[model samples]
Target: MDCMFKKIAKQGGDIQFDDVETIIGPSVKLEGEFQSKGNVMVSGVLIGKLETSENVRIETNAQIEGDITAREAIIAGNVHGNIIIAQHLSLLSSAKITGDITAGSIAIQQGAQMNGKCSMVATVEPKPADVKQNAASVMQDTTELL
Candidate 1:
């Protein structure tokens, strides 16, 4: 049991995979939001949002029904919500996406089905207090001048 625990731990908690980079199985189903600090490979059905600081890889047989917020995402399955990626997004041949996508880079395979808008954008940092204050003051002064 100790060895089994160790093996499972190495594969990332309760999720099991033959390869750390691959998630392939038929009977898996996940519900509710999932937050991961590392990469995620999903081959099952997920009914909630996926949040990852690294990359998210969804296999061809997988189905996700909620939003995805990640640094990068590679999808080969079905997605039904908005995708907000900081870096890159790729849709493979079997992908079926039905919502908007915002990412720094994107790639769509030939046979993929996509029905949404895509925007290439950079990550934005919040303005510092000084900058915000200065801008507000400038705007006020301009309005007064007008």
Candidate 2:
């Protein structure tokens, strides 16, 4: 887990996978909107809108079939929908986005792919939370996913 954030020092490395409140595992396939106030990390298939007030990380093997709205995002997978970020967004080399993008700032790696229009918006500030809570204690519908 520590190795994953080594290259993401810019966001202050404040959000980690282990500290995520909602995690969609690689083998799980979910079909519903994901709304949360806390950070989320998806490594599987999500077939609905995802909105959050915090950071989001979409892993290399993940696949998203709907729009994503978040404060910030780190994507390294395939996204079939639009993305809107309040702050910075990083699209790794393995990322493949097929929809429009709206973000305050963006970093695209050499091999990243995005096939739609992009717009930059004004971002006031960014402040990721420092508190971490166990996923098991989270009462969200997607918690403790099997």
Candidate 3:
């Protein structure tokens, strides 16, 4: 295991890929969506979505041009679309992301550059009742001030 994987695993992430089922090498350039049930390691360029039930690792030289959905993700490259991780998302110093992120939890290194909104999956959804109650409370406060 590399230092990056070790760090992610230590942080309670699902990034242990002892049995990687998919590997996109650095020289490879793929298009279209990629889906898998097991661990995926990408060191190439992918021009479409990536969906996996297990961990997805994007290496330093890798680049992804579309969204990513995974159980967990460790990114050390460039990503141009949204990322949704069910467990955790770790962005290394070399990572550069340009889209929104929704994750259970996230860790970003000092030099990582991310330019989008980030929301925790557990808190992103607003309950209808809460919204209605908030609106009612605001209306009541306004009426009292008038």
Looking at model 3, how many pairs of residues clash?
0
What are the clashing pairs of model 2? none
Q: Which parts of model 1 are misplaced by more than 4 Å?
A: 1-25, 124-146
* lDDT of each residue in 1-146, candidate 1, tens digit only: 12211222211122222224434345788889888877677878999998877777787788999998987677889999989888767787899999988887777779999899988887823337878999999999999999
Q: What does candidate 3's lDDT look like per residue over 1-146, in tens digits?
A: 36533535537534686777898988999999899999899999999999998999999999999999988888999999999888788999999999999988899999999999998876434347989999999999999999
lDDT at residue 15 of model 2 (Cα atoms):
39
Model 2 earns a TM-score of: 0.76
| Model 1 poorest 10 in a row by lDDT | 3-12
- Which of the predicted structures, 2 or 3, would earn the higher lDDT when compared with the native? 3
Measured against the true structure, the TM-scores of the candidates, in listed sequence, are 0.69, 0.76, 0.78
Candidate 3 pairs with clashing backbones = none
Q: In model 2, state the lDDT of residue 137.
A: 47
